[model samples]
Target: MHQPNYIILQCYGYEAVFLECAYALMSLSRLYKPEELTNTEIWVYTDKPEWFDRFADCPLPLHFRKMDAALIKQWRGDIDFVHRIKIELLLDFTETRTGNILYADTDMVFLQKLDDVWNGLAPGELYMHMQEGKISEKGNPLFRKLDTFLRSGKAIKTEGTPLYDLYMWNAGILGFHSSHRELLQKALEYTDSEHPKFPKHIIEQFAFSIQFGSKGNIKSALPYALHYWNMKELRQIIASFLQYFDGKPWADLVRYSSLLQPYILVTEKNMFLQNRSFTEKVLNKKWVPAMPNWELLEKQI
Candidate 1:
């Protein structure tokens, strides 16, 4: 048997995140054949593994690993830096694991076959979700805050030059092989030392960009996946869908229901204002009471 590629995710506190995991897994089932799916493993690191018990019968192989919340709190210092766990997990995989690893946020859906994306990745390469424009002191809002931190001597400087010259990336999805251990270690080092200087929410991405942005190996997976990180309204919709149809097979849900379709349509429209408006419209139209008739909704799809 071929060595399996790992799909990693971290979720805690929010029970609803498990639903996101189910949706992501459903998307994966839609894209991959049974053999390909069998070769892939989904590992979720969470503080509450018991919540995942309900999904024991899911088609995909799911592994739930407990998170060390105490250690996470210590690493975060005074602030609740939950995202720091991502760097720690990446370090663990790169140091201890032997195969290719892909870490994706739960708020994503696979749109197509990922073989091309996986095949495109080379050893020692790190793939990010997408790239934003260059960081600039005069034009960007966050850079001004970063500039102050740099001037204060608290922030550890990158190997060469300041962050203003480097590009920014969305850290929603990251892919790497075990050969990139040193690169992941550097990112962790920056996270440990410079997190206070950067905004807590985005510090991890900044650390990753500082180390890998200049490298030509950084690639984007935007084509194979759709990330709904900014769509708060859509997240609520998904949460509702999952709760309404709890315990049902994801493969059936993906094939028979239109729950995931709205997300694709909104993304295709690509208008922020229009998307928000449509999200609100859907929320109002699809709003259900405490007990929803999921069968009726399923049949409607």
Candidate 2:
């Protein structure tokens, strides 16, 4: 059976970010058996390759690509263009490789078998994290920055496309087949050009939204994975757990940590708070129970 290729990016000197990457890999190891992931290739693009040396014994076969600091600096310029690297890395990966590619952020955790999700991907389709809402030059909080870009002439409006018709999607988890290389290429081109127009934080995601208008075949990956982007408090808790098991083997670390049940619980609670509807909150009053074995997690180390 053929397996899909997975790519993750971690650049510069954020130690917490690096720990997140390790924890993500550990989650992958915990979710799938060895034979299930046997032929799958996992690549990490990073400027600080040595930081990943500690994960040398990772159960999953890992490949490390050292990023060019000068090129990154030139592409990023003065603005905080950290997310732009994701576009560059995706373009680089799709150039030489073929077939299903799954690109994920470091803060995501896999909760179930993704074989069905991988199998469902078809050629000429692009899957994104989640569709936020339609884009707008006014009224919408997210796209007001894009409106500024349009007003400044930094971004060009596509012919026949109204600003409100273009939908914005989160870029945390992206899945595309080799046949849709041009889709990613278009995103890279926009990132290299009108990056200044986008808000420094969501430039890559906004650029992707522009390239992938309503016409783009965008699917959702929310059922298979959990994205903990911007959940700082939960991230700190997970970091503490990773630090406790700093030098342990990946298999042993995952086995002893109860497969990151506590981390998953915390993440779910945070997500529920952010996404729960008013009716759900009122009627579905039952809250997710807190992890009972916090002391056990610490004692295992």
Candidate 3:
């Protein structure tokens, strides 16, 4: 039998936001109806372990960990936060012996069953957030500036380093086999390298792009979940989304603004929930993979 598992990265905070994120995920869990439903293992990595102990008797097998917030504060590299999450996954994967894994962000609600995703895993292949555009695609004005910085000869360098570029990805929900251990190693190398300053989220994304290469090993996924508010283009995308949503049922927003959503999804949980519900509506009753490459206002790196 194919064993399935779920992982989530979280931190304790205001009750409403936590409830919103948990509800969205639990709602998705209810939809999947997995056999291990009574014993489905769910691992949560957080700085606040106490927040999750309340569910000690729940059907979902819950594992919790308290992470050092200082690493995030001091290094703040692109892959730092997620790299830690991946490490948590790596360690848990070794310990739990779960054969298949589905990684999700806490703030998304699943609209359809994920059995297909679980069944689709191929040997040696792992699920990754699809890059929005082609490799050769040049980024927008702000991103161009970021590229300039990378090439400016001022970045921290290490041997075998490759200059990076790639599209954005909203990692709300992704499925992959536990077999792709090499991917995690490669991602860590990319994130740990010296840089003038630590790369934030984009570093891991860029590393993932390079790791997957042109074959697009991590093929695009139909929109399955929505990440809430991201900070990259906090000002513009919000305005554009309001315009894009334009009186449509809030659920239809992602279809219209998928290209811009990833950059804004991680910043605010409440906004993420509100917009995710709206985007879920127009997304072709099935998941719609996000658009890869498009001009977007860049953030300070």
Give candidate 1's error at residue 33 in angstroms: 2.9
Best by TM-score: 1
Q: Please provide TM-scores, in order, for all candidate models, with all chains considered together.
A: 0.81, 0.79, 0.58
Please, what is the whole-model Cα lDDT of each candidate in the order they appear? 0.69, 0.68, 0.49
Q: Pick the candidate with the highest lDDT.
A: 1
Where model 3 places Cα greater than 4 Å from the true spot, the runs are: 12-17, 34-39, 53-58, 68-98, 149-168, 194-198, 213-216, 229-301
Greater-lDDT candidate between 2 and 3: 2
Q: What lDDT does model 1 reach?
A: 0.69
Error of 1 at 16 (Å): 2.6
Each prediction's RMSD to truth: 4.8, 5.6, 12.6
Where in model 2 is the C-alpha error above 4 Å?
1-4, 77-80, 137-140, 147-154, 256-294, 298-301
TM-score of 2: 0.79
> Which candidate do you rate higher for TM-score, 2 or 3?
2
